[model samples]
Target: MNAKEVKEILDSAKKNDVFLMEAVWTRFFPASVEIRKLLAQGEIGEVKMVGAEYGVPLFHVPRSDQKDLGGGALLGLGISCLQFISMVYNREKPESIQASGICLETGVDESVAVILQYSKNRMAMFTCSAGVHLHGEAFIAGTNGIMEVLSPMWCPTALVVNEKVTQYPVPEPSLPLNFTYSTGMRYEAEEVRQCLLKGNETSAFCLL
Candidate 1:
């Protein structure tokens, strides 16, 4: 289905009293909660900047060539990066957005790079590609140190303060597969339940 059609379906479901939501899974997980806690407790200090990227090399796929299918790096991966930025900054929209990309044969973007500027001199750099394998990592830089989230989409395992560029101990595992890993999706669902219980429509963590 086209992007517009998908949006329409979601709207219809919402109107019909159904819990219709886009499956943006990262917002509901343990990593997100920990990140939120850190931000709240000033663990990483004041968040000064954010950088994230997501990309995949879909070179020869037919659906990847169709603009009508929302086939492009911007829609595919850029949205995820944007979501990360939005979540970290408390769902505030960027004050300004500057984006550029390359259009491939089927009039779909092959790659894109965007810069989003937010309040308090905070900014985020985002990139996406359908032409190359991406090393997806997200970093939130603060006054004290930095918080690094590896694989922001699926398993957002976080890293604590690395004081020096010297050697550091191996990071411990954050979640177990199917058990704790599934907590990501469940956390988000619980957020929805809490919001409804509180007579709210949107979640503070995963607001769209």
Candidate 2:
């Protein structure tokens, strides 16, 4: 998992007192910011569970089906699910994990489902698939109400809160996928630029 290498890099970065960050652009999305606010403001009560799924039909691509080239649904889409959970629950590692997946001949996973249990009875269930076309939806359920991150949750343009279906709008691309991203990536880049200008080691919104 390159865990050791990542740790070393972080340690080195700290020792050198430099800024280093992982490229998870979702954190900078307006929808993401709104979700954080909703949780902090107790709009959804105390979050007890989070579910997320991101899948696309890309099995025909060489870079996706090849193991040596780091092809797998988990490697491709699971990070976003992990990020979604962290955005809700912070950076604490899951206390227990359960996973199952289907793999191709190259031993690369075509699909993966993982359930991560955290302390305080909180849980996160995430699924990523390469052979399927999923809605890329995410759900956050709490004691009082629930929040749904719209389709393509990783870069969604809206969030639906509660049974009343109260919609909170987020910024959308001037033209969908105009810059190779349905959700404009400029917001994240701008955040990074601000951090650099402020000499901050990491973003206040998006953590590595």
Candidate 3:
């Protein structure tokens, strides 16, 4: 959604006095939580850059090439990289964004690369593709050391900081799932439950 739409939704939710949350599930995962904790503790010193990539062969998927269906590598696959970058930056606005993409005949992007420039020399770079497969890893580089999220970073179960590894598996799902690590969704649900129990109108981690 655009900025105007997001603001409108936030306003409406506030006016209605109802709780609002965005299901950015990764933020609720244990590994994701650990990332924030480590950053806060200065485990890697001042973070200067974040690099991420997530790509899969989706060109054969019909919806992926259709503009009306919101089809595009950036929207369908790249959101993960974007979300991770946002989380690392705490949603701070980037001073500039540079992007490039290769579009399909159907007018949707098939591959994309982006660079988000933030203040204090901090920056984020990422790439996403619908026609190719990528390792789906992510890296956060800091003055002291570097942190890395393993492959499939969007729903990662492991992280490496300064060559030390940590793993946090998701709870098993009650039923079959179409996506990997979808069981992590339970974490997001529990967060919502806790927020409501506390009588909060929004989640501090993913407010509208």
Candidate 1 achieves a global lDDT of 0.73
| TM-score, one value per model | 0.77, 0.88, 0.94
lDDT tens digits, residue span 1-208, model 2: 4688789988998999998888788887777888888898999898999999999987788798888787889988888888999888978789999999998898889899999999999999999999898779999999999999877787766788885544434445565464335445777888989999999998877665
Residue clash pairs of candidate 2: none
Candidate with maximal lDDT: 3
Q: What is the lDDT of residue 55 in candidate 3?
A: 91
| Better by TM-score, candidate 2 or 1 | 2
- Candidate 1 error regions (>4 Å): 1-11, 152-154, 163-203
Model 3, position 199, has a per-residue lDDT of 95
lDDT of each: 0.73, 0.84, 0.92
Per-residue CA lDDT of model 1 for 71-127, tens digit only, reads 888777777787887878888888999989899888989999988899889888888
Give the RMSD in angstroms, all C-alphas superposed, for model 2.
Answer: 2.4
lDDT of 2 at 132: 92
lDDT of 1 at 20: 49
Clashes (backbone N, CA, C under 3 Å), per candidate, total: 1, 0, 0
Q: List, residue by residue over 62-127, the lDDT tens digit for candidate 3.
A: 888899888999988899999999999999999999999998889999999999999999999999
The parts of candidate 2 lying over 4 Å away from their true place are: 15-17, 164-183
